[model samples]
Structure formats: structure tokens, C-alpha cells
Target: MLRAEWTKIRTLRSTVITLALVFVIAVGLGVVSLTSVRIAFERGLPLVREDFEPVTDAMVSVLYAQLALAAFGVLVICGEYGGGMIRTSLTAVPSRGRFYAAKIAVCASVALVLSYATVFATFLTAHWTLGKYGPSWSSDGAIRVVLGTPLYLTLLCLFALGVGTLLRHTALALTVVLSFVFVLSPLATVVPGLREVAHYLPDQAGSSIVKVGQQADPVIGPWAGLLVLAAWTAVSLIGGYLVLRGRDA
Candidate 1:
């Protein structure tokens, strides 16, 4: 079942395109950002030393690349439903639980591997561009950022998958996921009184893992923030499972 699921995902042209975009957008933009920062520092832009975060600045592209990853997750199951392939898949597997598990496993595995590759490529590109300014693997918090990048992306992918499963519509799922991550979360941070609540949002909480220093008035530590994001993912997946099991494929 897992093998079948893998084959289905691998055969999709959009999957290839989306994953390629993830790599290019992350590495390409990271290199550009690092280069620009290096130029600015060399020109004596008076940038605050205390505010400098080479690690986080180098990987700034992840914010944009995540949208592509989210779309990939949505396309996985939603595409099947959109094209009327779910019925055939359900017929072949016979057990919805087994089928859903296999699908989630394949999605998570692919997203994790691709995300790691993107993060590593971006890190190397930044190192090349920023030279001394870039964070090395042994640098403080570097390992955590590198390892957490993929984990963060994988969890986001799974969260999108769960939402897609529940909605069973590509446009609707993408709208909800994208808006929540890109719109509502950011809005909450700038709006007074909502900032505290926003700190616990899936995207906001997950972002702590990638940051290198203490955040201002942090609601949770890096590990705790990851746990919070994981909790959200678990809830989304459980909700999706319940809906999928109860509904006709």
C-alpha cells in the first residue's frame, strides 16, 4: 500500500514541479538575501549588530518556499478527489484506514526528504555567499535550525494534508491553509492583545524552532513551540481521520 501511494505521488508532474520550485526558491532566494546582507554590511549600512541573525537571515526563503510545500500537500489527496481517483483508490485498498495511513506516510516521507534537501542546499548557498557571516554546522543553534527546518516543513505538510482530507477540495483546502498561515497568523502578531494568542499559532510556534536567539516576550521555548505545533498537527490529522472514516469515499 505504501509503495502504491509512493508511486502515485512520484508519477504526478505537478509533484516534480512543486518540489523543484521548493529547492530553487529556497536556495536561490537564500543566496540573494545573504549576498545583499553582505553588501550592506560592507557598505557600512549602520545595521544594528545586536539585531544581526545570520542563520535566520540566510534561510529567510523558507517563508516563501513553505507555500509551495503546502500546495504540494494539498495536491496529494485533493488532486485524487478532484479527478475522481479516490473511488478507485478506495476500491483497490478496501480499508480506508490502511489507505489513509499509507497516504500520510508517503506524504510525510517525501516532504521530509525534500525539505531537508532544500534546507541543506540553502545553508550551503548562504555559507558561500556570506562567507564569515554564515553559520557553520557547529555554530551555536545551527544544528537545531538545520534539523528543525525539515521537521517544521514536514509538520506543515501533514497539517495541510489533514486539512485537504477534511475538505476534499483543492481550492478550498489551499485557501484555508494558506490564509491561516500567511494571513491570519501575521495579522495576529501585529494586532494588540492578539499577539499573545498568535504566539501559540501553528506557524508562529513552529517558527521558534528556526530562530537563533531569544524572542521578545516568548510564549514558549523552541522545543515547547515545536510540541505545540505537533499538537496542532495531531488534532488536524485526527479530525481528518474521523471525517474520512465516516464519509463515503
Candidate 2:
């Protein structure tokens, strides 16, 4: 089952496009971002307290990685439905549990590899470009994004997969997942009273774990933010599983 799912994912054009964006946007934007920061410092412009995560600033490409990875996750299963392949997949597997498990496993494995490679590329590139000005690998934000970004991205893929499974339509799933990753979360953050509420939503909560020093949201710490993301993934997966079992393909 795992093998079958892997085969399906690797063959898809959306898989290739989305994963490539993960690498390109991460590395490409990291170079642009860090170099621009370096230029700003050379010109005597000062970084404000609110945006003072040097390590995260260097690896700023992650801002875009979030969406690409989430889109990849949405495509993994939702594409099958879009192309009228889910019914055949269910017929072949016979057990929705095994099928869902296999799909999740394949998606997780691929996400792990891709996320690590993308983060590492951005990390190495930032340090190389910034030289002595670069933050050490052991620094708090450096460690968090180096370690946590990949995990953050991987979890996002799974969360997206779960949402995709529940929705079972490519357009709708993409709309919802992209909003979750991009639009809605940030909107909630900037709103007057919902700042605290944004702290717990999946993207904002998960992102807190990646920020340097994380001064804004006093409530959640790095690991706690990760747990919040994990909790969201768990609920999404469970709900998706229930929906998968109760409905027709």
C-alpha cells in the first residue's frame, strides 16, 4: 500500500512543482533576504526590536516554504479525487484505515526528506553569505528553525493531507488549506482582539516555535508551539479518518 501511494505521488506533476517551490523559494529567497539584510547593516540602518531575529531573518525564505509544502500536502490526496482516482484506490486497498495510513506514511516520508533538504539549503546558504555576521548554529533561533522548521513543514503537510482527505476536492482543499497557512491565520493575528486567539491557530502557533526569542506571544514557548501544531494535526487526521470511513470514496 505504501509503495502504491509513493508511486502515485512521485508521478504527479503537482508533486514536482510544489516540492521544487519548497527548495527554490527557500534557498532563493534566503539568499535575497540575507543579502538585503547585510546591505541594510552596511548602510547603517537599524533593525527594530520587534523584528530582531537575526537567524530567522537570514533564513527568511521559510515565509514562503509554508505555503508550498501545504500545497504539496493538499495535492497528495486531493489530486486523486480531482482525477477520479480515489474510488479505484479505495477499491484496491479495500480497507480505508490501511489506505489512509499508507497515504499518510508516504506523504510524511516525502515531506521529511524535502523539508530537511530545503531548510538545510537555506541554513547553509545564509551562513555562507553572511560570514562572520551570521548567527551560530547553536543559537536559539538558529536551532529552532534548523530543527523546528523542517518539523513544522512536515507537520503542515500532514495537517494539509488530513484536511484534503476530509474535504475530498482539490479546489476546496487548496482554498481551505492555503487559507489556513496564509490568509486566515495572519488576518486573525492583525485583528484588534484576536491577537491572543491567533497564538493558538495552527500556523501562528507553529510559527512561534521558529521565531527567535519569540517576544510577541508571551504565552506559548517553542516546544509548546510545536505541541499545538501536533495537536492540530492529530485532530485533523482523526476527523479526516472518521470522514473517510463513514463516506463513499
Candidate 3:
């Protein structure tokens, strides 16, 4: 089942194109951001050293690359539905549970590999661009950030996959996921009192894994933040599974 699902993903041209975009955008924007920061520092910008996080700044493009990954997740299942392939898939598997599990497994595995590649490429590009201003692998929390990048991205893909499964529409799933990631979450900052609640948002929580030093009064630590994001992913997947099981594909 997993192999079948993997084949489906591999055969899709969008999968290759989207993953390539993820790599390019992540590394390209990372170099630009790190270089900009290095230039600012050289000009003696008023930024304090303790307040600057070279590591996180270098990988700033991860936030944007996540949109592409989320879109990839949405297209994974929703594309099948869009093309009326879900019925055939269900007919072949006979068990929606196994089918969905296979889809999730394949999606997550591919996302993990792509995300790790993006992170490594972005880190190396930033290092090459910023030279001594870039964070070293031996720096505190650097290794954690590198390792956690894939986990963060994989969980996000799974979350989007769950949402896509439940919604079963590519456009609708993309709209909801993109709005949540880009629009709604950032709105919490200026809404008053919502900032506290927003700290537990999937993006915000998952982001903790990649950040070094203290942020502005985070509700949880990095590990705890990831647990919160995982909890959200679990809820999404469970809800999606229940919906898929109860409905006719």
C-alpha cells in the first residue's frame, strides 16, 4: 500500500516541481536574508548582539517555504479527489484506514526528506553568504534547529494532509491552510490578548524548535511547543479519519 502511494506521488509532475521550488526558495531567500543582516551589522545598525539571532535569521525563508510544502500536502489527497481517483483508490484498497495510512506515510516520508534537504541547503547557503556572521554547527542550539526543521515541516505537511482529507477540495483546503498560516495567525499580534492564545498556534508552536534564546514571553518551551503542535496534528488527523470513514469516497 505504501509502495503504491509512493508511486502515485512519484509519478505526479507537481510533486517534483513543488519540491524543487521548496529547495530553491528556501536556499535562495536564506542567502538573501543572511546577507542583508550581515550588511546591516557591518553598517553598525542599532540592533543589539544579544537580541540578534543569526541562526534563525539565516533560515528565515523556512517560513515561506512552508507554504509550498503545505500546498504539496493539500494537493496530495485533494488532487486525487479532484481527478476522481479517490473512488478507484478506495475500490482497490477496500479499507479506507489502510489507504489513508499509506497516503500519510508516503507524504510524510517525502516531506521529511525534502525538508531536511531544504534546511541543509539553506544553512550552507547562509553560511557561505554571511561567512563569520553565520551561526556555526557547533553553536548552541544549532544542531537542534537543523534536526528539528524536518520534524516541524513534516508535522505541518501532515496537518495539511489531514485538512485536505477532511475538506476533499484542493482550492478550499489551500485557502483555509494558507489563511491559517499567513493571515489569521499573524493577526493575533495586533488584536490584543489574542497574542497569548496565538502562541499555541501550530506555526508559532512549531517555530520554537528553530529559535535560539528567549522570545517575547512564549507560553511554552521548545519541546513543549512541539508537543502542542503535535497535538494539533493528531486532532486534525483523527477528525479527517473519522470523516473519511463515515463518508462515501
Which lDDT values do the candidates have, in the order given? 0.86, 0.83, 0.85
Cα deviation of 166, candidate 2, in Å: 1.0
Residues forming the 10-long window of minimal summed lDDT in candidate 3: 213-222
Stretches of model 3 off by over 4 angstroms after superposition = 45-50, 214-217
Give the total clashing residue pairs for model 1.
0
Per-candidate TM equals 0.95, 0.93, 0.94
Mind giving the per-residue lDDT tens digits that candidate 2 earns over 34-138?
887777667777753455666767656876877888989889988988899999999999999999999999999999998888888888888887766666787
Full candidate order by TM-score, most accurate first: 1, 3, 2
Candidate of highest TM-score: 1
What value of lDDT does candidate 2 attain over all alpha carbons?
0.83
In the predicted model 3, the residue pairs found to clash are none
Error of 3 at 16 (Å): 1.8
- Candidate 1: C-alpha lDDT: 0.86
Model 1 spans with C-alpha error above 4 angstroms: 46-50, 214-217
Clashes of each: 0, 0, 0
- How do the residues 81-169 of candidate 1 rate in per-residue lDDT, one tens digit apiece? 98899999999998888998999999999999999999988888888898887778876788888888789899988998999999999
Best first by lDDT, ranked: 1, 3, 2
Candidate 2 regions off by >4 Å? 46-50, 214-216
Cα error, residue 44 of model 1, in Å, equals: 1.3
